[model samples]
Target: MDNNLTDRSFWKAFWESRIGLIFNIKRDYIFGDMLGKIKAKKGYQTAIELGGFPGYYTIYLKKYENMDTTLFDYFVHQGLVNELLEVNGLKETDIDIIEADLFSYQPETQYDMVLSFGLIEHFKDTKAIIATHLPFLKDNGTLFITLPNFKSINGWVQRKFDLENYNKHYIESMNPALLASYCKELGLKDVESYYHGKFSMWLENKGTQSALAKAFVKSLWFTGKVFTKIFPFESKALSPYIVLKATK
Candidate 1:
């Protein structure tokens, strides 16, 4: 059974917005720092990102870590993925593309790294969904997962301003401690999970918003950027993402 809370149309509209064009220094910093830590552990050569479409993170893995990466997605939005690759000065051949469903598809070979960003939280069965990625990872290979921390201030903003978007995510799976517990329960070694970014009002909604609400959100976003710049820190209440790292 397809357990995805989000459907193809949601992804299609999401990719069409081209929100990646807007750059956030804080977001980049948090992601880059995490990747650096992963790189420090070992030199990973090959990686596969499950449910990764329009492959921005995979591009970063290639450019920064010099990993041969593969993007595995259903390709319901293939045109947008192709366009993104072209815009990034990459051809379709530059990165391996696998069109498959995450729940049932089996990889031909395992990889040094198996990752997914903001993917698993859409499913109702968090542990079951996470276990599906393990088969694609080689022994001692790293498993990295990141999901929006919707149990924080950002959650409040999302719930109030974008209830529709908030409802799509499985809130029970948003806890860092719970994520860590799940990884450990799956028999992964050295499991670690924690709140990631300091603060950010980043929302995935590109839909219409009230002028007052937009201004309020923007104010909070600006304040968060300035505050994080001065004192970079993350806590359960303020952080925007939860990162989980483990080894198979």
Candidate 2:
């Protein structure tokens, strides 16, 4: 939360995507659990991912979901998808890389699933988002999107950085509620969101009592000791990131 000492050089980890992708999308398949909730229909067999920076989970989707994946990005070469797929030890034919502007791109065919992480907040025109993927989503397809919430640790960082530029800071921190309504209006069947990553949000969500708050919070220190043991998924809520899964 405190950017006072976080030099720009230190922020390189956040800017350099490939490294972050490994830690963000672990081999455990967090998205796999979310996909399990989405049952494919009779003829549904494909999925598309938007803003696929570095293609971290492309291999996972092919291996686990067993569906053809089309990757759409504003800036990707003909072999970006193939390069990542091969880096992950996956075949070249398993994924399709499409380089197009998401705001107006059209898909050749429909898909059973769509993945968009941390992009909705960047764009205000929700219709543009729907137009790009709605036709591509087969009946009962899943749209799994992740974005930062005001309750995330990133918020704390932004808030600190905000001292330099107030407007940019507030924009970086957004409410998850807006996303909920966006999903509902888009004809998404089930809307569920979780607060994940970083520790400040957890502390803020689960309020404290000054009298015994120090003692209780000391016991609840956002550490792996009790977090992994008591509530792993719920612990995600205390963190700084937001992950949502819904169906169309």
Candidate 3:
């Protein structure tokens, strides 16, 4: 590869690593509630995250439940995942960090909870997700998911283009109803969807037609809490990201 391409590749990897680790480590409190939902049913012992970006969620879950879990992903973002683990004072053996694409890896056992946040929407084949991802769930297990929604104009445009790369994910925005169907297909019951903060919620509206789109999004982000109070479920009303809590 040329220096430019190499540089881009390195930065891309670095970006994924750093953001994956530092960003969004905090529990998707909206989604994390599903962990409790799962515990109400089967109870978890061994939990695994398929596309753990920087091990933020991995470490968070470990600390939250005192879990000795597994983190799996190819670590395409330089060595960000590995670096984060070490920085967090986690030893190599402390986690089963699989630097491999999850599509090819299969597990021999089942788990009590299966989490794939910000992951499912990347693929087009929802069936593959059910095949590879949900099986980790033990009976009555809980599976938590977040995917991009196409309810707005920007998301619609992204989904309309050459989206083959995200064939395994949403690559497009999503409809909660459709996602609920997928959860049902996974044999999960009591499926519920949630969104965070008001900014993301306002973005969910099909208000992309407004010329002041950028300004509108900014206002929503800055004052989403106010908006949420005035318009709860506004996240679902405006944005594409939704948290699904389903039981098997």
By descending TM-score, how would the candidates be arranged?
A: 1, 3, 2
Model 3 over residues 110-150: C-alpha lDDT tens digits? 77677777666555565565556766677777777776554
Error of 3 at 187 (Å): 3.3
Better of 1 and 2 by lDDT: 1
Q: Judged by lDDT, which candidate is best?
A: 1
Regions of candidate 2 where Cα sits further than 4 Å from its true position: 1-26, 36-44, 77-80, 125-131, 158-173, 197-237
lDDT of 2 at 133: 60
Give each model's whole-structure lDDT. 0.81, 0.56, 0.58
Candidate closer to the true structure by lDDT (higher is better), 2 or 3:
3
Score residue 159 of candidate 2 by CA lDDT.
46
Name the lDDT value of residue 114 in candidate 2. 80
After the best TM-score superposition of candidate 1, give how far the Cα of residue 205 lies from its true spot, in angstroms: 2.9
- Per-candidate alpha-carbon RMSD to the true structure: 2.7, 8.5, 6.9
Candidate 1 lDDT over residue span 122-226, tens digit each: 999999999999999999999999999889889999999889889989999998888888899999998989988789766666347878888899998888788
Task: Give the least accurate 10-residue stretch of model 3, judged by summed lDDT.
Answer: 1-10
Q: Candidate 2, overall lDDT? A: 0.56
lDDT, residue 125, candidate 1: 91
